[model samples]
Target: MKPLSRVLSRTLFYLLVIFVVVYSVFPFYWAVISSFKPSGALFAADPSFLPLPFTLEHYKSVFLQANFGRNLLNSLLVAGGATLLSLVLGVLAAYALGRLPFPPRNAVLYLVLAMTMFPQISVLGGLFMLLRQAGLFNTHLGLILSYLLFTLPFTVWVLVGYFRGLPRELEEAAYVDGATPLQTLLRIMLPLTGPGLVTTGLLSFIAAWNEYLFALTFTVGDAVKTVPPAIASFGGATPFEIPWGSIMAASVAVTVP
Candidate 1:
C-alpha cells in the first residue's frame, strides 16, 4: 500500500508539472499559429491549432506598413543602453554599499529598497516634467534614462547582495598587490559576480522592453517609438476593427527573443 501511494504521488507531481508547462506555453503557441492564419480564418467560429490555411500577409503587413523595424531597433537601443548603464552603476554602488565600512550603510540600503516599492505611475508625472525640462522627451535617450529609474534600483539591490557574499580575503589579497578599489572590483570582484550581472542585466532589459505607460507617455510618434506602443498604435481600416493578426505577428516577434 505504501509503494502504491508513493507511485500515485509521483504520477500526480508529473501531471502537475505537465499542466503548468502547458498553461505557460499555450498562449505563445496560439499566437504563433494565429499570426500565420489568413484573415478569414482568424475569426472563424472554429479555430485551429494548426495554421491550416497559412499566409505571410500579416507578418508582411507588420514589416511593410508599420515602421516596425525601426520600432524594434528603438527597443533594442533603449533596453541595451539601460542594461549597460544599470550594470556599470550597480556594480560601483554595490561595492561601496556592500564592502565599505561607512556609516549610514544600512540606512542607504533600506532607502534603495524603498525606491522600488513606489509605483511607476506615482512617479510618471514628475519624470515626464523632468524629461521635458531636460529636452530628453520623445527620444530613445529619454526612454533609456526613464527606464534606469526602475532598473537601476533593482540592479543595485540585487548586486549588493551578490557583492556581500564574496570573501573578504580576496579583497585583502588584491590590496596586498597594491590594487585600488576600482581595480579590485574590476579584476577580483566583478568576475565572481558574473552570474549576478547576467541575471540583473537580463531583468533590466526585459523591464525596459515591456514598459508601456512610460514608453507611450514619453514618446509622441512612431518615428521614435518602441515595440509596445508601436504595436498598440496598429489598427485596421476602421476604428471598430483591430489588426489582430498583425498584433499576433508582432507579439510573437518580440516574444521569441
Candidate 2:
C-alpha cells in the first residue's frame, strides 16, 4: 500500500478504537459525575463535565430511602446463583460437546444455540404464569432460573471452544490409568480451563445483573427486585419527579464493584 494510504488506514483504525472506547465508557463516566452532583446540577442545561464539588446525598438517599441495600443483596444472590448454576452446567455440556461427543452432538448444540436466539420477552408471560403457579414467583429462585435462560447458552459455547483447544492426551492418559471420566474431568480438564471458566462466569454474572425484563415481570414487591429494576423504578423526590441524581448514584454504585 502507498504511504498515504497506510497513514489513512492507521488514522481510521485509531479513530475507530477511540470511538468504541468513548461509546462504552463515556456514559459510565457521566453517570458517576452526575451522581455526585445535586439534583439541580444533575439536570443542569449546561452540565459541567467535571464535578467541581461532589456530594454523597444521592447515595445516602438511595440506601436509606430506597432500601437499595436489600435490593442490592437480592441482585447479588440472584446473579451469583445463576452464574454458578450456568457455569457448572455449561462446563459439563461444553466438555461433552468438545471432548466426549455423543450421537447428534452438533445437532443438540445447534438447538441450544437456537434457543438462545429466542427473545426473552417472548417467554416472559408464560414464565411468570408458571412461576406463579409453582409459588416461585417473587422469589430468588425464579429470577435465577429466568437469568439462566440468557446466560447458559453463551457460556456453553465459550467453554466449548476453550475446552476444544485443550490437549486431550492428558485426559485420555488419565482414563487409561484407571481414573474415571469424572475424575479426569474434575482433576485435569477443569484446571486447564480455569481462565475460560473465569471469563464465562464473568459474562454470565454481568448478564444476570443487567437483566431487567424478567425481573420486572416476575417480581413486584421488594422480595425479589434486583438492581436493574430497582434503579429503573426510581421516581423523583416529589412523588412523580425523576430522582436523576439518586438514579445516577445507584447506577455508578452498580457499575463500580
Candidate 3:
C-alpha cells in the first residue's frame, strides 16, 4: 500500500506539470495551426489540431502585401546590433565592478540599477528630441541605442553576478604569466563564461526584437521599422479585423529560431 501510494503521488505530480505545460503552449500551438490552415478552415465551427488542408498562402500574402520580410530584416539588424553592443559593454562594466575596486563602485552600480527601473515613458520625449537633434531618428543606430535602454541594465546585473562567482585566482595567475588585464579577460575569463554570455545575449536580442514603442515612435519608414510595429499597422477600428492567419504566419516567421 505504501509503494502504491508513492506511485500515485508521482503520477499526479507528472500530470500537474503536463497540464501546466499544455496551458502555456496551447495558444502558440493554436496560432501555428491556424497560420497553416485555409481561411475557411481557420474559421470553422470545430477546428482540428492537425492541418487538414495546409497552405502557404498566408505566409506568401504577408511577404508580398504586408512587406513583412523587410520588417523582419530590420528587426534582425536592430536586435543583433543592440545585443552585440550591450554584451560587449555589459561584460566590460561587469568585469570592472566585479574585479576592480574603483571609487564609488557600489554607488555607481546602485544609480545604474535605479535608472534601469525608471519608467521608459518618462524619458521617451527627451530621447526623441535628442535623437532628432542628432539626426539619428528613423535610423538603425537610434533603434539599437533605444533598445540598449532595455537590454543593458539587466545585462550588466546578470554579468556582474556571473563575474563575481568566477575565481579571481585565474586572473592572478594570468597576471603572473605577464598577461595584461585585457588579454586575460579576452582569453581566459570570457571563454569560461560562454553559457552565461550566450543566455544573456539571446535574451537581449529577443527583447530588442520584440520592442514596439520605441520603434513606432522613432521610425517613419518601413526601411527602419521593426516587426512588432509593422504588425500593429494591421490593427484597425470599426470592425476592421486583422488577417489573423497572415498575422500568425508573420509571428511564426519572426519567432521561429
Candidate 4:
C-alpha cells in the first residue's frame, strides 16, 4: 500500500509539471510552426501541428514588404537605451537609498514604490504635454523618457532589496581599508551584485520592448516606430482582408529574441 501511494504521488507530480510546461510553451510553439506554413495551409480544413510543406513566403513578406527589419532595429534601440539609462540611475539611487543612513529613508522608499502604482493613462496627457514642450515629441528620446516612469521604479525597488541583502561586513572592510563611499560602491558592492544587476536590467529591457501605449502615443513616423505599434499597424491590400499569415510571421520573428 505504501509503495503504491508513493508511485501515485510521483506520477501526479510529473503529470502536473508536464501540463504546466505545455500550457506555458505551447502558444509560442504554435506561433513558430504557423509562421512557416503557407497562407493557404493556415486556413485549411485540418491544420497540422507541424509545418508540413513549409514555406518562407510569410517571412519574405514581413521583411521585404512590411519592412519589419527597420521596426526591429527601432525596438532594439529603444529597449537598449531605456535599460542602460534605467540601470545607471537606478543603481546610483538604490545604493544611496539602501546603504546610506538618512532621515525619512523609509518614507522615501515608500514614495518611490507609490509612484509605480499610478496608472499610465493617468499620466499620459501630462507626459505628452511635457514632451511637446521639451521638443521631444515623436522622438526616440521621448519614448525612452516615458518608459522610465515604470522602469525606474522597478529597477530601483529590485536593486534596493538586493543591496539590503548584501553583508555590511564587506562595506565595513572596504572602509577599514581607507576606501571612500564611491570606491566601495564601485569596487566592492557593484562587483558582488552582478546577478541582481542582470535580473533588473533584463526585466527593464523586456518592459520597454513590450510597451505599447507610450510607444504609440510618443512616435508617429515609421522611422521611429517600435515593434509593438508597427505590428499593430500592419494592414492588407483590401480594407476587409486581414493578413494573418504575415502578422503571425512578424510576431514569431519579434518573439524569437
Candidate 5:
C-alpha cells in the first residue's frame, strides 16, 4: 500500500506539472500560429490550431507599416537604462543597509519596502508634473527615471537579503588585507552575490519592458514610445474592425525576446 501510494503521488505530480506548462504556454503558441495565418483565416468561422497557409504579411506590416523596429529599440533602451541605473544604486544601498551598523538602518529598509506597496497610480499625477518641470517629459530619460521608483526598491531589497546571507568573515578578511569598502564589494561581495544581481536585474528589465501606464502617459510621439503602447496603437481602417492578425504578429515578435 505504501509503494502504491508513492507511485500514485509521483504520477499526480507529473500530471499537474504538465497541466501548468500547457496552460502557461498555449496562449503564446496560439499567438505565434495565429500571427502566421492570413487575415481572412483569422476571421473564419472555425479557428485552426495551426497555420494552414502561413504568410509573412502581418510581420511585414508590423515592421514596415507600423514602424515597430523603432518601438522595439525604444523599449530596449528604456529597459536597459533603467536596469543599469537600478543595479548601480541598489548595490550601494543594499551593501550599506546590510553590512553597516548605522543608526536608523532598519527604518530606512522598512521605508524602502513601504514605498513598493504604494500603488503606482497614486503618484502618477505628481510624477507627470515633475517630469514636465524637469524637461524629461516625453523622453527616454523620463521613462527610465519613472521606472526607478519600483525597480530601485526591488533591487535594493533583494540585494540586501543576499548581502546579509553572505559570510561576514570574507569582508573582514578583505578589510584586514587593506581593501577599501568599494574594493571589498567589487572583489568579494559582488561575485558571491552574482545570482542575486542577475535575478534583480532581470526582474527590473522585465518590469520596465512591460510598463505601459507610464509609457502611455509620458510620451506622445511614436519615436519614443515603447512596444506596449505601440502594440496598443495597432488598429484597423475603422473603430468597428480590429486587426487581430497584425496585433498578434507584433505580439509574437515582441514576446520572442
Candidate 6:
C-alpha cells in the first residue's frame, strides 16, 4: 500500500510538471510551425501538427517588404540599453537601500514597488509630452528612457533583496581591508550577486522587448519601431485581408532571440 501511494504521487507530480510546461510552451511552438505554413495551409480548417508545405515566403516578405530587419535591430538596441541601464542604476540603488543603514528604507522600497503597480497607460500621455518637449520623440533613446520607468523600479526592487541577502561579514571584512564602499560593491559584493543580476537583467530585457504601448506611442517610423508594434502593423494587399503568416514569422523571429 505504501509503495503504491509513493508511485502514484510521483506519477502525479511528473504529470503536473509536463502539463505546466506544455501549457506554457505550446503557443510559441504553434507560432513557429505556423510561420512556415503557407496561406492555404494556414487557413485550412484542419491544420497539421507540422506545416504540410513548409515555406519561407513569410520570412521573405517580412525582411524584403516590411523592413522588419531594421525593426529587429532597433528592438535589440532599446531592450539591451534598457537592461544595461537598469542593471547599473539598480545595483547602486540596491547597495544603498539594502546595505547602508538608513531611516525610511522600507518606505523607499515600498514606494519603488508601488511604482510598478501603476498602469502604464496612466503615465503614457505625460511621458509623450515629456519626450516631445525634450526632443526625444520617435527615437531609440526615448524608448530606452521610457522603458526605465517600469524596468528600473522592478530591477531595483529585485536587486535590493539580493543585496540585502549578502552576509554583513563580507562588507565588514572589505572595510577592514581599507576598501571604500564603491570598491567593496564592485570587487566584493557585486561579484557575489551574479545570479540576481542575470535574473533581473533578463526580465528587464524581456519587458522592454515585449513592450508595445510605449513603443507604438513614442516611435513614429518603422525605423525606430520594436518587434511588437512592427508585428502589429503588418498588412496584406487588400484592406480586408490580415497577414497572419507574416505576423507569425515576425513573432518567431523575435522569439528566437
Cα misplacement distance, residue 256 of candidate 6 (Å): 0.5
Task: Indicate the worst ten consecutive residues by lDDT in candidate 2.
Answer: 38-47
lDDT of each residue in 71-171, candidate 5, tens digit only = 99999999999999999999999999999889999999999999999898999999999999999999999999999999999999999999999999998
Candidate 3 Cα misplacement greater than 4 A, ranges: 235-239
Best by TM-score: 1
Clash count, candidate 6: 0
**CA lDDT scores, all candidates in order:** 0.94, 0.88, 0.88, 0.92, 0.95, 0.94
**What is candidate 6's lDDT per residue for 58-159, written digit by digit as tens?**
999998988889999999999999999999999999999999999999999999999999899999999999999999999999999999999999999999
Tens-digit lDDT string for candidate 1 (28-132): 999999999998898999888999898999999999987999999999999999999999998999999999889999999999989999999999999999999
Q: Write the per-residue lDDT of candidate 4 for residues 1-257, one digit (tens) a residue.
A: 99999999999999999999999999888888888998788899999999977999989998998768888998999999999999999999999999989998889899999999999999999999999999999888888989999999999999999889999999999999999999999999998889999999999999999999999999987888999999888888898877888888899888878
TM-score of 3: 0.93
Task: Write down the TM-score for model 5.
Answer: 0.96
Which has the greatest lDDT? 5
Q: Against the true structure, what is each candidate's TM-score? A: 0.98, 0.92, 0.93, 0.97, 0.96, 0.96
- Alpha carbon lDDT at 92, candidate 6: 97
lDDT of 3 by residue, 1-257 (tens): 99999999999999999999999999999989888998789789987998779899988888887778889899989999999999999999988887787898888788768878877788899999999999999999998998888799888888888888899899999999999988988999988888889999999998898888899999997889889999877642336766788788888888795
lDDT of 6 at 22: 98
Off by over 4 Å in 1: none
Model 2 lDDT, full chain set? 0.88
Model 4 backbone overlap count? 0
